[model samples]
Target: MKFTKETRNAGRGRRDLLSVAGAALATGLAGCSGALERDGDGNGNENEDGNDGDSDSGSDGDSTDAAELRETLAAADPYRMHQYGPSHVGNAGGAGPTSDVDAVWTFREGADDSHYEIGTPAVVDGTVYVPENHSVGDDGAETVVYALDGATGEIEWEWTYPRGTAFGSTVVAEGAVVLGLGGSVVALEADAGTERWRLERDFSDAVTVADGTVYAINTTYADPPTLVAIDLETGRERWTEPLADERMFWPTPPAVADGTVYQGGVELTALSTADGERLWSKDFGNAVTGPPTVTDDACYVPLGDGTVAALESDGTLRWRQSVERGGRGSGLHPVSSPAVADGTLYVTSAWRLTALDADDGAQRWTTETAGDRPPVVADGVVYASGLNVMEAYDGAEGDRLWRYETDASSSSGDKVAPVVGETAFFPSAGLHALRGADATSD
Candidate 1:
């Protein structure tokens, strides 16, 4: 899809201007409120000195001034993926907005066209990154990646590829944005839209990065599939391992935790992240729908037959539960991955959001909704997107808190999982920036 910059509305009233500024400031503060440091392993965590190693405020004090916090937040780009990490746990970690939310901005492209599709966006620093695909006459389709101001909905930079379509979500890692284009994995400079490097391969899923390495899957209809790893910094080939002898179709992205890379297709496969060696594999006799959610002790795989299997880290089966059994004869199972937070697993089946005990696979609660995208958890609340509304519920009890109507269609197959920072970011027809109704009052 080709995108041209649209003019920004300059007729906003004083109250609207203040609202945008306040939302931006809140987003900055929220980014700074977390542990922004990266340890020696490059995973984000506090340093041994009990301070955020990435903080520029230094060891002089724990409190940071507003100016320094804003700068730090803008540079950190906290929430950048679908579920906040490669595991697809969908937890935002810190506090998120709780009160009723109002739209701060809406960004749209080709507003009159109905044939274009927008992929899920990645939010970092203060910018929203989105990829759009549209058909081009009788030839192939085109894909365009865009960066928009998170607060104001203004385009910052956009790059179009004339030959390929980007169907998977984008990943932002180590100062660059990585995505799959046709038969290649391309990395672009996040700030300038300049090409860093491209690795040619038939990538079937989105790219996942961990400990400085990029992991992706390559598949063909009649050929064996392979799991390939590349160095994120240089885009150099690291290792490749044949996944299976049979044809693997629509492989889910690999989730790396500890030292194991978990991928699911016809079965669940675990491989060593060091050399792409297969450690273990299990056949559920059913196709695994989405990427497996990994934790320190267990791996959760969602199946196409409405069953969720919890396996031990070493590939032992813990338990399996059928959360949704073709609700009302619809014969639809969950295609979205499960999100884990506070010892609870959140998943969507048919038209309901179900929460289960992560350890024992026990049902906790279920709430009726209109859509089936995975749910996101932050600060003891779960945010889910229904047909045309986003709803927030208390995490522990599944009690509804508030719902905000949206203009975007939730049935587009482009799952809309809200990205939480100081405010909640939702993407549909366009991107929407929202803040809690009680934010200013608090």
Candidate 2:
């Protein structure tokens, strides 16, 4: 079950100078309890990429349509792992919370009278699986994964871990909820929150589960990270492959789509989901900002040096577009992962949001905003979370639809992206579920 390849850096990347320091900054959250280690642009970028989750269970049977979410989420890829599924599309699809949203319920609990941050959630059959790590009594720490009723935002069951660092992502698939906790990959029964399996490692990133398999990226901190595949039914390792020969400081989780698993690091690689077979890898001369957004026809990735690149299935470059404004002293170097829905690509940079045609990478529209996390598209609206602000825009016209200002951490990419279930979930120290005042399930 050891998948290793002697793959070295394809070429010296442009950001190699800061790789060592950046990696520490990227993975720093693993050291703290509930504190997020994020690469911020004040615009939504990765949703932090792999914070997403999945489940085969039915919907909440409310205004949110789980069936519809399953359909559109599966349109390009499975809701395999986090960051809004394997395609990394960030589209909740189906019946999402529209304009004039109201808080239906909020999922929050304090440990020792202090609140912890909530990570991304995966909804299945009406339950929300979310994880959080909190400090206890100034010295102790605890990691808890709660299974909440999507309709009511009430905790139905929770599984607690002795150690923290597992708050990065919570994923539910194949009747199991999986997450990375304190350098280990843990799986629990989705309904009972009972421990199903655990695999200890040194360093673990966000996990992705697809087609009864769990893909995990782990490292020992002394070397580079590795991509590991595990059987969902059993804790047995399927295969593990080294993602980079040289270390990657802040690589996002792997995206599984179209029978291919796309991994980003110093290089962008495509692998076979069946076995750890390398399909193609390209040295982009830059670092990948987030998970690769793989669509039916092409794959898109945000580069570290502030640009977005499109690739064909064969790993060939299609087109490269610069979302970075302020080249000649504009001082704007916006970097975030790309979210694609309805053949449109959305990226948020420093103080601006840009929409582009998914085909050919032509600019569709751009608007000035304060978003920093990767944008989430659901029901044709782009949800951007920035410093003390949340704004929605028309996916096609790029017009500002509505704005909701809040005390929520502007570091939304680290806490929770826009998780649209029966309602659109936002993280503001606690998990908030919102639904449109006049919206109905389709």
Using lDDT as the measure, the top candidate is 1
Q: Give per-residue CA lDDT, model 1, range 1-442, as digits (tens).
A: 1123321122223332332222222111111121222223322122354211011211123223223433433664266665777777788766666766655455554323334456667777867787766555554566778887655555788888765343556788788888866657888889988888988766653568888888887754326878889998899989998877865455666888888899777788999999998999999987777778988788999887777899988899999998853242134454457889989998876557788999899999987754456678887888876434566788889877766553332123335555555566655444555556543222
Work out the TM-score per prediction: 0.78, 0.77
Give me the candidate number with maximum TM-score. Answer: 1
lDDT of 1: 0.64
N/CA/C clash count, model 2 = 16
lDDT of each: 0.64, 0.62
Candidate 2 lDDT: 0.62
Off by over 4 Å in 1: 1-77, 109-112, 134-141, 325-330, 409-414, 438-442
Instruction: Show how many residue pairs clash in every candidate, following the order shown.
Output: 3, 16
Residue 98 displacement in candidate 2 (angstroms): 2.8
All-Cα superposition RMSD per candidate = 13.4, 10.2
